[model samples]
Structures are given as C-alpha cells and as structure tokens.
Target: MGIVGYFLPMLICAAIPVQSLSRNAETALCQTQEMQGLCALSGKWRNQLQSEITITCKKGTIQGLYDSTVGNGAYDLVGKYLQVNETDYIVGWSVAYKNQHRDARSTASWTGVFYAAEDIIKTQWIRAAFKNPEDYWSTFTTNQDTFSRVQSHPCLHNNRN
Candidate 1:
C-alpha cells in the first residue's frame, strides 16, 4: 500500500497534461493580435554587430531601430503594410537574423506586418522576395550587379550576393 501511494502520484502526474497545457497556453497567447504576427517569428535573432533581438508579443511597444538605435519607430498596421519609421542605418528595411555557426548573419530584408491595437510588429524573411523583384533585389545588391543578376535568374535568386 505504501508503494502504491508513491506510484499513485506518478500515475496522477502522468494522467495530467503538462505539455498539452503549455501548448494550449502558448497557442492562446500567440493568437492575440499583437502576438499573431510574431507567431512564426518569436525567437532569438542576432545582427551583424552581435545585437540580440528578442521579439515578444506581449503588452508593449515593439521598437524599430535607426543606426541600431530606436529612432522614429512606429508600430502600426497602417493599410496593407506595417509601417515603421525609416531608420537611418536600417534603410527602412527589417534585417532578418540567421543563426549559423554560432554567429547570426543579417539577411537583406524582412517582411513586416504591424498590429496597432496590440502594439506589436512582426518581421521575417523566410524566402528571398515577397513581391516586386526589382525592389527587393536593390536592397541587397548594387545597381550593376542587380541588373546582371536579374538577367540570369530574373527571379532574384542570387540577389542576396
């Protein structure tokens, strides 16, 4: 009976859900308007200067950067795009951090979508270009290279070079 008592607690724990409960909470939390945009991007992102970017979708302002400093930053879902004030050093584009070899590589651009009510802005660059091949290409390549590269792939595959 004493052994059964110890096993009973273990059995009860096994019966109760811990992972599921956490997942349910996470899903519910992420579904919130502020977090909705970041549901796919809530992670540790690092920049070339080894700057750490922690994106959380809670009740707070998601600040944008100018010269790596928050400047003229706005988190609003205005119209179809999430408009953040253009940063001096950032060139009005969001940089996606790629974690590789214990170092994060800053990608050319990221797709931004802001939620005003939630005071959250989400940015990510999963693929090369979201739209407008020419526009996305120029962000990463110079005029000469952009023209040449567009000639071959024409899809901006190697535009990141």
Candidate 2:
C-alpha cells in the first residue's frame, strides 16, 4: 500500500477511539454524583431560620438569592468537583448584602459534600471574611450549614379521599 493509503486508514482508526473516549467522558460526567448534586440543588432551599435561598446551577457555577427577615442578598458561587470516593465539591461565594442595618458584603469559602441518598448539600463554611473591617467580628472561622431541598407546593395539603 502506498503511504497515503496506509496513513488514511491509520488516522481513521485513531479518530474512532478518540470519538469513543469523548463519548465515555461525557457519559461519566452525566452520571457523576457531583452533577447529580448540582441538578438536585438547582431548586429552592430553606434553612432553620426560615430563610429561603433560590439557587440556579450552570456550567459548574451557582447563582442564588438569599431572602430572610434579617437580610437579603444575592450570591455568585463557583464550584469545582473533587475526585473523592464520594461526591465532594469545594465552592466559594461572594454575597452582596442589601437592605440590612449595615450595608456590607462578605465572601465565604465552603466545602460541600453531596449526599445523594438524602438529596442534600451538606456544606461547611471553612472561612468567611467581611468587606468592611467593622464586621470582622462576624467572620466565621468554621460553621456548618445544611441546605435542605424545599418541597414544591408546600402549602398544598395532601388529603387522601
């Protein structure tokens, strides 16, 4: 076989494996626990304080609005999936606080582990710092927060007829 004929077949065979590998990678990402967690967390969540957070996840990033009686804010969070045996992600968020006694902003770094079975994003704020020096006392060295999925149609009463 001439050089052209031999190289053509070799390139075709190489391209086939590359395409298969690409598909496999996509499949793996689709089924990854991290992705599943992102999907599950894309909805609304509520904390014990009766505060509500509406989160939207897109391309490994999260944006949310936190509404509470004390303060309301918007946050932009970025996350990276970790290669732990379980589904783990590290995320950081910058919150712009509004309508509060003190107009201030804060940034927090969190380590989150997604519990697929419970459909909850268990997060720990590893570090938090405020933009204003006066708010330094409020800085959180370590704090644990759980974001539970908010049930849709919470006001609807389920009555069996």
Candidate 3:
C-alpha cells in the first residue's frame, strides 16, 4: 500500500529499458569509423608543461588551438582523428610554434590515442628545431607526454597530481 513498495516495482522494470536506450544511443553516435564520436574529445586538456589545448572535432577533422604556457603563446593545430578497431580512439596532429623559453624555432608533431576510461591522451612526440641542417642529430628530440582533461568543476574524488 506504501508508495515506495508500489513504485519500486515500476522503477525496476523501467531501469532496464532506460539503460538499453542510453547504451544504444551512445553506440550510434560514438562510433569512430563514422567519425561521429570525436566530439567526446572536445574539451580542454592540460599537458605536463602546463600547456593547454582546446580542441574541437567535426567529421574526421580536428580543429584546435594549443596554448603554451612556456612557449611563445597560442598556435593553431591541425590534425585528424580516427577510430581504430571500432573501439580505440586514435589521433595525430602537428603544431608549429616558436619556443621563446628555449629561444628556438621548432615544429612539433604528436601521435597518440585517447583513453576514454581515464579521460587522458598519452602521446609520443618528436620536436624538430630548425637550425643548421647538418646539426640533424641535435635538431630532433623525442619524449612521451600525458594530457589530462581539465575539469570545469572538480570532482568529489578528483586526485590529479
């Protein structure tokens, strides 16, 4: 006779369908092969250098800007997004900017995959400094970087270091 007793049964029955619809809709819009789900990557990301990147995705193309806290300033980035194995979110992009901190001209390119579970992008990048062509050995350097999504509002359990 209580409302809780009556509504519990109805709520339980409704839960399955609501969950199914949500799952189905996510699959339809988030498929990587169709480039529909790149929107998931749209947001602000912070790199280890404290550099910030704001990215937007449409179709298979990515348009974004990289703001270097340590470098010159802000630079436009061009890149492509792909869905591999229909489950993995893959991305590659390049940016050319002057590194005022290093007093050098350089172009850096990154190839990485977005980890949805962790909301992070791990990348390996090769930065080439423009200098004497013969100084090729010292011109290029490689390193791995992790970019974490910058939350607009911190989570209750946000423990990012």
Candidate 4:
C-alpha cells in the first residue's frame, strides 16, 4: 500500500486527543448499560448464599438493592461500573451495615466483574465487624461468590438455566 494509505488511519487517530478517546469510550459503555436495553449487567441476581441483589448500571455508576438471608434485612447499595480499557469492565460496590459513631462502622465491600460470555458476576469481598474506639485489632472475614442473573440475558434467552 502507499505511504499515505498506511498513515491515513494513524492520522485520523492522532487528530483526536487521548482524553477525548477515553470519554468517547465511556459514553459507549453507558449506552450499552442503559436501563432500556437488556444486553447485560442490569437485573436481579442471586448468589449461592441465597443472597439476592438487584443491580442497575448507567453512566459508569451502579445502583441497586441487596438482601441477605443471614443479615438484618435489605439495604441500599451504590457503586461504580468502570471500563478501564477496551477489554475490562470492573464492578465494585459497598453495603454499609452500621454507622452510628466514629468507631462504630460495619460494612461489607465487594469487587468483581460481569462476564459477558457466561453472564455471571464473580466477586471477592470482605465483611468487617465493628470494633471499639481504642481497639488495635479488627475482626473481618473474606469470601467469594459467583452471582447468576435471575433472568437469562436476552441473547441466551432459551439456552441458559
């Protein structure tokens, strides 16, 4: 191919700043995660622990409700839906159990991803128990869970259980 032909693509990319490219990518991600579309990452999901969470994704934010059978009850959740690059979409969220005083804070936090191919969210988390104001040691436990969508993705309508 001619040199102009080879450099045309490069020239086109160079015309757009790197920051602009990043913003465009984020916008595209939001489009896919919009509420109206059923492509992925917006639904009711349940884990093996019988914990159910209803997730909603939009504009790089994740908002939902989580209910744990073993915990007090249901709670509101807020998190991020991040696209670090072309191949990575990371999900992180927090459910705070208590917050009455400076040292009286308890929470469970999670970080994971939604696998588009299998439509499952595999995550690792830490559940931290509140400690006394002057305590040096804190009590916490770690665990992992795989969350499956309550309803199948549209593309896998009749193919998945």
Q: Evaluated with TM-score, which candidate comes out highest? A: 3
lDDT of 3 by residue, 39-106 (tens): 55655689988987766554566666788776766776768888665445798888888434345478
lDDT of each: 0.29, 0.48, 0.63, 0.62
Q: Count clashes in each candidate, considering only residues at least 3 apart in sequence or on different chains.
A: 0, 0, 0, 0
Per-residue lDDT of candidate 2, residues 89-144 (tens digit): 44444444534454545454556775656766677765455546787676766877
- In model 2, residue pairs whose N, Cα or C atoms come closer than 3 Å (at least 3 residues apart or on different chains), thus clashing, are none
TM-score of 3: 0.64
RMSD of each: 19.9, 15.8, 15.6, 14.2
lDDT of 1 by residue, 80-102 (tens): 22224431111114444322222
For model 2, where is the 10-residue window of minimal lDDT?
152-161
Q: Which lDDT value does model 1 have at 153?
A: 12
Q: Which stretches of model 1 miss by more than 4 angstroms?
A: 1-21, 39-42, 56-161
Between candidates 1 and 4, which one is better according to TM-score? 4
* Model 1 error, position 8 (Å): 42
Sort the candidates on TM-score, descending order. Answer: 3, 4, 2, 1
TM-score of each: 0.23, 0.49, 0.64, 0.62
